[model samples]
Target: MKDSIGEKQVKVVIMKKFLIFIFTVFGLFVGWIAFMVYSYERSYNEWKSSYTGKIVTNSEKQFSSSSSSTQNYDYKKYSSSSDGNKDDLESLMNMFMKRLFPPTLLDPDYTYAYEKAKSWSKKHLSQQQIIIYLTKYDRYSEDATQYALNKLNVDWKEQALLRAKSYQEFHYSKNKLVEQLINIDKFTQEEADYAIEHVHFDWKENAVKEAESSSNGGNISKERLLKILVEYRKFTQEEAEYAIEHAKIDWLN
Candidate 1:
C-alpha cells in the first residue's frame, strides 16, 4: 500500500520535483551551447581549408543525380552553371539572398518558406529565383522546401502569356513582343507564338499611339511618322499605312 502524504510533506515533494525539471532544462541548454561552439570551430577549419584550395570532398554530399528526384542541392549554392539563361543572374541572386538567412524566432516550417518563395517567383520573379530560394533558406536541408523545389509544377507557357499581357501595356508590336519573349524572357518559339496569339491589344491604336508620342526635333512630317511606326514599332506595312492615314497630326513647314 502507498503511504498517505501529509499536507506539509506533499508541498515539499512538489517543490523538489519542480527543481529537478528546472535542472534538467538547464543541463540541456548547456549541452546545446557546447554543441554550437564545436560546430563553429569545425566550420572555421573547413573554411580555412577551402580558402587554401583543399578539396572539401569528405564534407561534400550528393542528394541525387536527376534534378527531378531531389532538390539538387548545390553545396556551393545557386543552380548549375549549365543553366541556359545568362540573363537570370540578377534575379537569381535576389532569391538566393532571401534564403541566405531565416527568421531567428517563430521560424515557419521549411515547406511554408519554400512555397512562399515559389509563390513570389510565380507572381513577380524569374525561374532562377524560384529554383534555389528555399533550399538555401533551410541551410540545404533535405526538407519539404527542397522536395517542392525539385518537384514543382511550373507552367512556363503560362508565364510567357502573363508577360506578353504586361508588355502589351507598353504597346509593343507583335513582332517586338515575340522577339522579347523568345530572346530576353527565354520562352520557346511555340510558347512565344502562343503568347502572341493570346495577347489582346489594338495594333492600329498602338501605331497611332507611337506616332502621336514621337518627340522629333523638327515639325514631324506624315512620311517620317510612317517610317517611325514601321521601323521602330515593328508595325506591318498595312498597319503603318493605316496609322498614318488616321493620325491627324499638324505636319507643318
Candidate 2:
C-alpha cells in the first residue's frame, strides 16, 4: 500500500510538469507573436515619419496650354514609396490592399480628372472640353471620367457662352462659331444656335474685321474680299457690302 501511494505522488508530479511544459510553450508562442507585431508597427511608423506630405510635379507635361481662359483650378495626386522589402508585414498589408481595392476601385486617376473637370466646369468648360481634357491630356478612361463629368451639376448654357466668348475673342464669325460648336465641340444644333443667338457680337463688324485681316496682304481685290465676306463668312450680301465699304483696307489699290 505504501508503494502504491508513492507511485500516485510521482504520477501527480509528472502531470504537473507536463502541464507546466505546455503552458510555457504557449506563453513563448504568444510572446513571439506580440514581438513580431511590435516590430512591424515600429517599422511602419519609422517609414511614415521619414516621408510625409511631399509633392512632385510632372516636369515634362505634354498637355496643350494655349487657351488662356482662367478657370477654377483643382487637382489631386497619389503616390507611395517602398524600400523593396517583400517579406515585411507592410508589404503584406500593401498586397492585401491591392487585392481588396484595385487601381480601378481606388481610381486615383479618375479622382484627379474628376477634380480637374469640376474646376474647368466651374470656369466654363464645355462637357466636350472636360471630356477632352481627361481622355487626351490626362490619359484617363474616357467613359469613367465622362461619367464623373456628367455627375456634376453645371450650367450648359453658361458653358456655351464661355465657348462663344473664347471664339469671339479670336474674332470668329457667327456661322464659324456655330459650326465649330457643332462639328468640333460636339454641341447640338439647337445648343449651338442658342449660344450663337445669345452671344453679343455684331456680325457686320466681325465681317469688317475679317476683311481687314485678309487685306493685310495687300492683294485682296474688292471682288475677292466681297466673295470672302459673303460666301466664306456666311454674311448677307448687304452686310458684306457694308463691311467691305467700311473696312480699314485699301480695296482700291
Candidate 3:
C-alpha cells in the first residue's frame, strides 16, 4: 500500500508540470501573434502616409498646369481683336499679362514663360513698349533688352532704367541694393558705378529699423551693406564714405 501511494503522488506531480509547460507555450504564441499584428499596422500606416503625400504633390502640379492652360487661352482671346483701339487693347493686354505671369513664375524653371514674353514683345511691341512690358513683367533679359537700350539712343532708356531700379528698390531686399551691388560679380565696375549713381535710395527711417530687426542684420558685413546701398542707388559718394567710416567704428568691433 505504501508503494502504491508514492507512485500516485509521482503521477500527480508529472501532470501538474505538463500543464504548466503547455500554458507557457500558449502565452508565447499569443505574444508573437500580437507583435506581428502591430508590425503590419505600422507598415500599413506608413504606406498610407506615403500615398497621401504623392497625391498632394500630383494635385498641386495639376492645378498649376490647368492655370497655365487657362492663361494661354485668355491671352489668345484678348490678343485676337484687330479692330480694338490701341489704348484699349494695350490696357487689356497689360491686365491679362499681369495675371498670366505672376511673380511666382519668375523662377528659372519658367524659362518657357520668359521666352513667350520675349516673342510677344518682338512681334507686337515698340522698343519703348517692350521695355515697359519687360520691366513690368520682371522679365528683364540683360542680354536682350539692356543691350538694345544701349543701342537705341532713345530717351526712354533712362526711363526704363529708372523704372527697373525703382521696382527693384521696392521689391528686392529691404533696401539692401547697396549690398547687392557689391556682391554681384556679373556687373562690371563701370556698370556698377553707373547703377549706383542712378539707383534711388530714398532712405526711410522705418526701413532701416526693419532691416536692423531682420535675420540678415547680425551676419551682414559692411562691404555687403555698401554694395546693397550702391545697387539700390541710394548712397551718395559722401553717404557711402560715411557709412564705411561708421561701420568700421561701430559694427566691426
Candidate 4:
C-alpha cells in the first residue's frame, strides 16, 4: 500500500508541471501579438500626419499665387481708367472757350486759354488732331496782344495799330499811345497828332523831342495829326500844335 501511494503522488506532481508549462507558452504568444499590433498602429498614425501636412502646405501656396495675380490685374485696369478721364476733361474745356468769344476780341484772353488747351491736347488728343483744330479756328482765338508785341514784322504792324486805337478809345494814357506810335513809322500824321493832343504835360516835352528826332523832321502830316487830336475831347487844337512844335528829336532817329 505504501509503494502505490508514493507512485500516485509522483504522477500528480508531473501533471501539475505539464499544465504550468502549457499556460506559460500561451501567455508568451498573446504578449507577442499585442506588441505587433501596437507598433503597426503607431507607424500608421505617423504616415497619416505627414500626408496631412503636405496637403495643407500645398493649399496655402496656391492661395498666395492666386491673390497676387488678382491684385496685379486690378492695378493695371485702374491706371488705364484714370488716364482716360483726365484726357476727356481737357477736351471739353477747350471747346467751351471757343464758343464764348468773337474773333476780334480773342487776343486779349488767348494766351491764358491756349495754355490750358495745350495741356489738354497733349494728354488726350493726337498731335495731328491738335494742329487741325488750331488751324481751322485760330483767327478767332489768336492772342492779339502777344502777337503784336512778339511778331515785330510788317505783317504785325496793322494789328498793333488797331490795339493802340482801342487803348485810346478807352482813354488810356497818351504817353502809352505815343510810345507805341514812335516805333511805328507807318503811323499816319493824324494818329501822331492825336497822340500829341492827349499828351500829358509831363510827357509833351519828351514827345516833341521824339518827333524831331524822327526822319520826317517830326513833321508828321498836319492834317492826319489834326484828325487824331480832334478825337481827344480833352485837348484844344492850339494845344496839339504847340506840343508838336516843342517836340525834340533824339540823335538815333
Candidate-wise lDDT, in order: 0.64, 0.71, 0.51, 0.49
For model 3, the run of ten residues with the poorest summed lDDT: 206-215
Query: What are the runs in model 3 whose C-alpha is more than 4 Å off?
Result: 66-253
RMSD of 3: 24.7
How do the residues 184-213 of candidate 4 rate in per-residue lDDT, one tens digit apiece?
333444655554564333444433333343
TM-score of each: 0.46, 0.53, 0.26, 0.24
TM-score winner among the candidates?
2
lDDT measured at residue 54 in model 4 versus the true structure, 0 to 100: 56
> Pick by lDDT: which candidate is best?
2
Question: Candidate 2 on 1-253: residue-level lDDT in tens?
Answer: 9999999999999999999999999999999778667766765665555333211123123134433432322112111123323334565565444444444476577567767788877766667777887788878797568667766777687678777777875667777888888887767677777888889898888887878886785667899888987788777788788888898886566
Judged by whole-model lDDT over C-alpha atoms, candidate 1 comes out at: 0.64
lDDT of 2: 0.71
The residue-by-residue lDDT of candidate 1 on 1-82, one tens digit each, is 2445576688899999999999999999999778666655665555456544522442343433346534445533456444
The deviation in Å at residue 16 for candidate 3 is 1.2
Ranking by lDDT: 2, 1, 3, 4
1-253 per-residue lDDT for model 3 (tens digits):
9999999999999999999999999999999778666655655565557657866986687567656578786776468546444544454444444344443343342454355455644342335455555566756664445544444444432433343364453434322453444343233334445555676644443234333433154566666656655455354445554555444223433
Candidate 2 regions exceeding 4 Å error are 1-106, 217-219
lDDT of 2 at 74: 18
The per-prediction tally of clashing pairs is 0, 0, 13, 13
What's the residue-level lDDT of 249 in candidate 3?
Answer: 29
